[model samples]
Target: MLFFFFYLFFFKLSAQTNLKGKIYFDNEPKSNVTVYLNNTTTGTITNKNGEFNLEVKNGVYQLIISHIGFQTIKYNFDTSTYTKPLVFSLLEEEFVLDEVIINGKENNDEWEYSFSVFFREFIGTSEFSKFCTIQNPDVLFFEFDSENNILTAEAIEPLHIKNEALGYDIFYDLKHFSIEKKFTKYLGYSYFKELKGNKNKQKKWRKNRLKAYNGSQVHFYKSIIKNSSKKEGFVINQFVRKKNNDRPSQEELSKARKELSKSNVALNFSRKIDKPKNSIDSALVILKKAKLPKYIDYLYKSEIASSDIIHKENNQTYLQFDNNLRITYLREKEEKGYILRNPFSKPRKAFLQASNIIPLAEKFIIYPKGILANPLDVLYEEYWSYEKFAHSLPLDYEPNNDD
Candidate 1:
């Protein structure tokens, strides 16, 4: 595994260029600032002069600069066009006092519940999440807005996360985290440093990483770029929601209810409906007959046949599609063994669905290096979106050569 990682690192560096930068705050050079590419392990720290240099591969990357007592900043740049030294000025964060106070007992209870929710959402719920620990949970502060049904969290300092499953200690400078009933979004900067492990432990991690990579979006993207999607056990199909036109009109519903009331036969074999006792009962019966099956059928038939649209321009490849896509990985399953496991593995539905279809705008172009320059180009729905930190791999990660 170490050899594989080394090979990848060297290969990437060979095709990379240098990005030098300095950090400043209030027109003064800031020392000891940590600078990194978001979602990748490539990073460096500012020296006494607040200057650092990084060798980055050809892709669009979010450059994150963070330090203690200052607001972290993320700047998106494409290596193809950004050939100048990057200068970042970070603002100092103002300290604010909490207006609301909670009693000791209440505070403890609320903190416990909120922390559990945040931990689950942040680290994820896979087997990896079980072993991942927040070494400094005390640095975290949580707030819940009951009226808006939103939960927010921030950190006083960088979160030290120990991922036993993947064998890495991640220094995560969490800028913001929020969770609502329908959606979860968080933005932060992270630096992943390898954890020392014995030979057996390293072997286990390698095996698990392979399992996680197999049917993942990263693998899918790479496969698509390589024109080997089918070879990689991925089956793609275009999906479209069925138009709902099965709703019964008021007159039809009224007629059906009257017929049901007059009939001697039962709605089901066990229970006979001689007559509805009230208008409410009559309406219930009518709705049960008119709505349930049609709704179910619509859901079942929502998917339509389609294929991924691939095109190339200026040596860069792009995927284009008009509707929702049903992505099926024949070899991937809801298993606990994969290191980079899917959070939505045990989905109720048979196939994974990616919806909220949108095209890749100029800002979201893909680089020839097989990285999504802008990951936020298309918003995923259902299972695809449920996949969070547990399924994430650094952009520099590559599957084992044997796999």
Candidate 2:
């Protein structure tokens, strides 16, 4: 029996399967880099020859490659073809810092033109973009005219537009309509925000204030240890633990008020964490890195949409925009009806369901119509032509995965 068990165990272990790969820099093997498999605990580091071996069961994996100076590379794992050893080549990013700083600037620029004009312009733009900017268009009208045998209509884009020229229209004749004046005005507004000195100061003050409040509250709880009154001290201790559990205790509320009166992280962290023991020091490190949640940003359903114009169309010209001038409106409308589906809602959610899930990386997918599957299938068509024109990164993409 012992001999048979040993044979079975060895067979199972060998069948577990091992993946091997080498990391190269400039065609020479490198070492000490971290290789991560996405959403899974499996990862490894390269040896002297830039080689790594990973044990994986049968499944797909996204192999993430990251190192000190190279831009990260992620590749999809294909279990069907395990014969060739995996090799990764990372490109040196000449302007990584520039890219990071410019991301928000570029993001805001996307609507600088359209938002400047009629906010309802996204009717010809992106549906997702329209959803974000406005709750509804000012007008949504479609009419058929027997006199000219034509469809006539107009609707504003659903974002708060600063100027008029920024928005566009796709007419039946394949002519693209964009207003120049409104777009320049919107760009001017962006420039105005960038030049404001007080804006940066205000942001810094708020950050410091939040940090100060968190630290002071933690400190106020520790103050109970010094109070000698047994009953009161016990009560305070209970309050401290309760605050950490359900809500902020009385002592924490008091400290929170104190923190609101000041705006200095350096001073508050120092005073609140006076006499740094090991535990306090570690706590301070965590507080420094923690970020406030989106809920704290006052996210509530807006009574109105943020789009440029809020117009409604009363005629049938809208269909003409969809069918004939699809290419002209391509750059202006990238994400038409593609939303991050809520995964917890039983439809098998995508990462984009929550507003907080920003795209950290992306890959382009190519496919013909009607082949890809759910959520992925819906977004594939949107990305086909406007991949380069839009500034944001794609969160999920699957080609030929549609049913």
TM-score of every candidate relative to the true structure = 0.73, 0.25
What tens digits encode model 2's per-residue C-alpha lDDT throughout 1-403?
A: 0000000000001244578888888888989877755423356789998998888654444566766456656577655567778888766744222343234235555323333333332222333233223323232222223455432222222122211111211111111222232111010000000112365654643443232222121121122222221221111110000112333444654555455446443434544554555544544434533332212222223221112111224521111011111111111221323332223334432221111111112311211111111112111112221121111111111111211
Go through the candidates in order and give the C-alpha RMSD of each one to the true structure.
7.7, 29.6
lDDT of each: 0.64, 0.32
Question: Candidate 2 versus the native: TM-score?
Answer: 0.25
Task: Give the runs in model 2 whose Cα sits over 4 Å from its true position.
Answer: 1-15, 96-403
Worst 10 residues of 1 by lDDT: 1-10
lDDT of 1 by residue, 1-403 (tens): 0000000111122357789999888888888898988656788899988899998876556787877788778787777777688888889877563643233114887778888987766776666677788999877777778899987887877899887777667888776678877556666666777678999988777776676667766676677777787777767666555544566666878876776678665455334456878554565566665743332211222322222456676865667765445566677554333323346446443333232333335334444344464555655544444445655556566776424
Q: Highest TM-score: which candidate?
A: 1
